[model samples]
Target: MNPRNNRQVRLRSRPNGIPQAEHFEIAQVPVEPLAPGQVLVRNEWLSVEPAMRGWVNAVANYSEPVAIGAVMRAFAAGRIVESTMPEWPVGTAVTGMFGWQDFAAIEPAAIQRRIVDEDLPISTALGVLGINGITAHYGLLEVGHPRAGETVVVSTAAGAVGSCVGQIAKLRGCRTVGITGGETKRRMCIDRFGYDAAVDYKAPDFEQRLAEALPGGVDVYFDNTAGAISDAVLARLNVGARVVICGTASVANWDPPPLGPRVERHLLTRRARMQGFVIFDHPEHTPIALEDLAGWVRAGRLHYVEEVLEGIDSAPDAIAGLYRGENLGKRLIRLA
Candidate 1:
């Protein structure tokens, strides 16, 4: 039987910088009965993403700010326990913006995509087969347009999306370089993710090391963190280079968008092309991306890791931890 109440992590206030556990409050409200066209989903895994930082902030980003005092918006994987709609039968697994709650009473439209690969773990729907994987695929191939024998550089290289990007770039016959935080993640980028070279941005000689790693210059750059690190990579771009801006993780505040990047002069000099990519803008192509990601996983060519924090209580500090590079892989909150 379902629990009597739904325990949730609700947003209490917006943060000026990285959101902390103190910004949220955990509360239990009685679960409402399922209404017409609604399904009761017992959310099992809550995805923790860097993009979530934009969600809670006062910034006007790709999506509207998650309202104050509302349930924290999140992508979660779960099973449908009770459904009023025949199309979504009970026992069906689903994933979508199910919020940071254990039980969700939501309409059919609330389900973004159903969990389809029975062989893969359900948690993957919120990780490898979910946002991170899809983002990596589209951002690299479609936007960056990496070619064989070219050098492809990725920022946040050992993290979920960057890791996937490095591996995919390698499979496409490109020489891959990873730019990450520390020695530990640097090693993981090379030893685990199959990058040709990995550079630690936190190192005192970061620029020198990064230049050494890219002797041929960057042909395609998949940038996840846009700050000083990106500025260094921009200077080393080969002619006709392509840069795909996937996220701006290093910037904490976007009250006014950062402008006049030093990279523009480099772009003009090298005849390079740079563009921003947000997956939500291409909903028509999401299914195709998912199908390819699943195929890669099943064939053993693609590898992904999960850094799962036990229990709903972990949701509060999760976004802050993500920005800190505390997670080595895709982070998730396991609700049991």
Candidate 2:
């Protein structure tokens, strides 16, 4: 049964630096009837990622900035409960940019992915089997291109995308070193995610530890946080190293752009290639990504973590929590 009111987390104001809990408010509005080629989806899980910081900020990203008074744009997984569209009939499980809402009356074109692996957990569609997996697959393999027996260091290594990148690097027979914030995640990198070694960036001896972790120097750097940690990694890049720019989590402001170590010298001396990865730009790799990621999940070759918070009200504070490094892995709000 379709709900009458749609509860959506609406952007009340654009933030100066990072999105805060106060910037959003949940409002329940009457669900509109489905128009032709439109489907009503009951969003079961809402995702909070590092990238949402850019979406709500007053800056141009790959996508347009989230306008004030609009539903806070986000990725969510749900089921089609009602449809005027044949492609997405009632009860079809799907994932899309459905925003932070309980229900959505969206056109079929809005659906980013059609959930094919119904046997797996529905939440995977938003994470490992979704953008996270796709981004890691292409960014590392296509962009970073780690060869077997190379040293691959990943920042934010225990995060959703970073975790996947670490595992995939290992699967390619590469030596993996994970750089994360806390001691807990550092241990998780070694024990849970199968990293050869992990360094805690918050530690006082972080540079020493990172150096020890990479005695032979870095062949591939999977960068998620582009700040001080990246500078350290950049300083130690091996000749012909590849740097994949995935996310800039630690960057507070990019309007005038925060100044840091110049990357040109590093790139020139190491003869390395650094390229930014926006997952939407690599749609051709989706099928292989979904296939291999799903197969790995079933075979226990890949593992994922999800920290689920309950209900729509949890959505507002979730993005801010992500910036604070509160969640262990992919953070999703589960609707009851």
Candidate 3:
């Protein structure tokens, strides 16, 4: 690899189920000169999210899948090293869809948000203050609409977005329940994330435990892992319950459309409202969500955790690790 080169993790092939390291190729390519109105960034941190699995899949989705031989798309935070735009001068800290690369030359329009809170860690721009936080804010408050004294349940409760959803729901005076994969995450959900109750989905008595936790029934169910865990949650929905469909982590693949217990009966019997939300569709809510999230952070009311991996090579395996429940919180890769 040349010293003056950009190292990037590109999509070598589409995966059948969960993506493997073989599906990605890390290559060193020459850094191109910045064009007019473009900024060159040295990415310090790259986000590894569950959504990346969908992005690499050949199946149709809300967004276009990453083409083979293209750089794997990702949200990254970095410092501007060179710039042709006055607004994005050298040393500006910014976050955007910069992909899994050590260096990126991006147009100003591609920049999503600038990291202005110097007091906070720059990585927070990719974690709590970034898409994860924003997604939780809108999905819970706007979509789920939990009222005081209501019971709110979140799947993947120890993960990035799910953790934030539980905390925010608690602030609204809702009884928050978290469903995670293992004992450690379950404990983290209750002890660290401040969920009223935490249940392990991997446990043999998961359904019984969930029933015991939500005695009053679930008023708001934030669905992150939509499979058997969701099936159990749907069965516990209160009349007029709100189901926020977020991520589908439990299902291994979407190509063949994995069959599960039908939800129409649950919705009809409970008079529930189920809606799917893609954060990208609601750009108008970003500023307000960020403002509220930042305020909560400053007041020490909101808490977050980040599990960072070192080097660009860690990007491929990092995604696999996320699905395997290896990451306790927000999984990130430090490229610099």
Cα misplacement distance, residue 68 of candidate 3 (Å): 0.7
Winner of 1 and 2 under lDDT: 2
Q: What is the lDDT of every predicted structure here?
A: 0.91, 0.92, 0.93
lDDT of 1 by residue, 212-325 (tens): 999889899999989888999999999999999999898877666676467668989999999998998877777888888899889988888889899998899999999878
Model 3 residue 314 lDDT?
Answer: 89
Instruction: Put down candidate 3 lDDT per residue, 1-336, tens digits, no spaces.
Output: 565799999999999778888999998899998888889999999999888988988885888999999999999999999998887889999999999998889898889988898789999999899999999999999999999999999999999999999999999999999999889999999999999999999999999999999999999999999999999999999999999999999998877788889999999999999999999999999899999999999998999999989988888788888888899899999875
What overall lDDT, based on C-alpha atoms, would model 2 receive against the true structure?
0.92
What's the count of clashing pairs in each model shown? Answer: 0, 0, 0
Ranked candidates (TM-score, high to low): 3, 2, 1
Ranking by lDDT: 3, 2, 1
- Residue pairs in candidate 3 whose N, alpha carbon or C atoms collide under 3 angstroms: none
Top lDDT model: 3
Candidate 2 lDDT over residue span 61-120, tens digit each: 898999999998889999999999776789999899999999988898889878989889
Say which prediction, candidate 2 or candidate 3, comes out ahead on lDDT.
3
